[model samples]
Target: MGTGPAPGRERFLAGAAEVGLQVDVVARAAAGSLAEAASLLGISPADIVKSLVVKHKDGTFLFALIPGDRQISWPKLRALVGVNKLSLPPADVALDATGYERGTITPLGSTHPWPVYADAAITGKRISMGAGAHGYSAFVDADALTAALRAVVADISDPN
Candidate 1:
């Protein structure tokens, strides 16, 4: 109702700061796709990091930080997480798990602080990712962001 940071934005800023990481929050218009969002941010689509939330059969969650031009490799992700079954939870389930809606989900300020798995391509690059809100994103040093989240970087994504 009020014009302020989104639900998890404030906490994300605090947490990033505590870890000596600087993240720049950018306001954007609602975008219908990754390419559109990239255009709005004046960056290449590859620079966008998509924080996709996935659920395991055991009821746990994980954040897959894939590049905008890629898609998660189910085999790689499952093997990395040591799970045979994983699923993309519904919007409500995702919000309940991470305290952010589907399109606005980020691992930065998640209510549950779930484990983050990032694509190796994102390392040592500047990336823009959801900032726990729709029409908003954060630009950050990939290494710092991954380190702050203690994310496991691996070849878990495929070219989309």
Candidate 2:
């Protein structure tokens, strides 16, 4: 760990710790995308879990964790969640709900406690994700991450 938490990494680490999940926070100069982040961290993109914020037609927000190499299947997600429609919330709404910017948002410590859905592929080992801020990341066991977030594991990712 550095002298201080980098950007939003601290929040996720704290949240993980509270739930008994061990986390290793890493800081980088500029990793704007999963590919870049992976390169800088010396890991594969598939090992990077991306946190996405989506809104239901009823205006409720939820979080989804997908592999960096994949994309969310909106249709499957809606059906799995039993929602009529789902789409990314507006930037302002996402920020308001998650208390972090789009790229840095994590399921941990959101302004509102929202349900979390994680891709089934994210299992069996350790994974990395944004720590509520950009240019920073945290590593935790995949199962532990899901457990900490109380996430529903599902095959909601598309092979994109």
Candidate 3:
């Protein structure tokens, strides 16, 4: 890592703090899969969450929190959002929307406070997710995180 301040990390930390959410950020080596990342972190894959940026049909976005062990259930999400269409925006659009690259995107410090949809599987567990920057993961109580962000909790995912 470079010997310098990481603005992405700073923004994420600040955002979490602003919402009174306590987060512990740890450096991580690049991993090819959720299982690999979980192994490296010594945690269950279910304890690792992926922060996915989902685009609404109306040129807006929402954050979808899916467990590493599962994938987004599009039909369920669409139903929950009361929409017929949703998509994973292109990387550039996602970066523009969240001020963080795809792999590091998290709602904690997004450029805009887009709505959040969290999978019910992660509720009440301690989970790890993107730290607003590459090579890092942030750990926090899932319940606290959702509460802090006022996320919509539902069964929005299926096994990967």
Candidate 4:
């Protein structure tokens, strides 16, 4: 674990352990967005899995994992989620729901166990994801990650 008392990191690690998933945390100096973080890590953005929080018209929150090199397709996501409308939640609302800020939101360690939907295009043996803290990310086997997070794989991403 990196320095600082990031509750998100704590919760994420705990969840990973609970699911018996081994993960490696890579700490960097300072990087905000997925592009910056990928650059700092010297890896392609496609290897970075970004956790996105989407809210339905009924105010229900869901998690979507998309490759950093791609973007979420709003129409496809709404249809997959069976919602009339879907939009990003406010920063504070996202943090309240996931226990992490915008730049460090992880599907794991959420305040509530929200459903996780992963893009089918993100196929790889391993991948990196935010560790519920900025400047930190976790590398884990893709299968282990999806299994641990209980993510549903779907085609909900638009190629970059």
Among these predictions, the greatest lDDT belongs to 3
Better of 3 and 4 by lDDT: 3
Clashes of 4: 0
Least well predicted 10-residue stretch by lDDT in candidate 4: 1-10
TM-score, each model? 0.93, 0.91, 0.96, 0.91
List of clashing residue pairs for candidate 4:
none
Q: RMSD in angstroms, all models?
A: 1.6, 2.6, 1.7, 2.1
Query: Candidate 2, after superposition: displacement of residue 27 in Å?
Result: 0.5
Steric collisions counted per model: 0, 2, 0, 0
lDDT of each: 0.88, 0.84, 0.94, 0.84
Candidates 1 and 3 compared by TM-score, better number: 3
Q: In model 4, what is the error at residue 58, expressed in angstroms? A: 1.8
Model 2 accuracy (lDDT, Cα): 0.84
Tell me the tens digit of each residue's lDDT in model 2 across 1-160. Answer: 5544453566666666677877887777776667988898889999999889999788888999999999999888999999878999889889988888877888876667789999999988688887877677778899988887789999999987
How far does residue 93 in candidate 4 sit from its true spot (Å)?
A: 0.7
Residue pair clashes in candidate 1: none
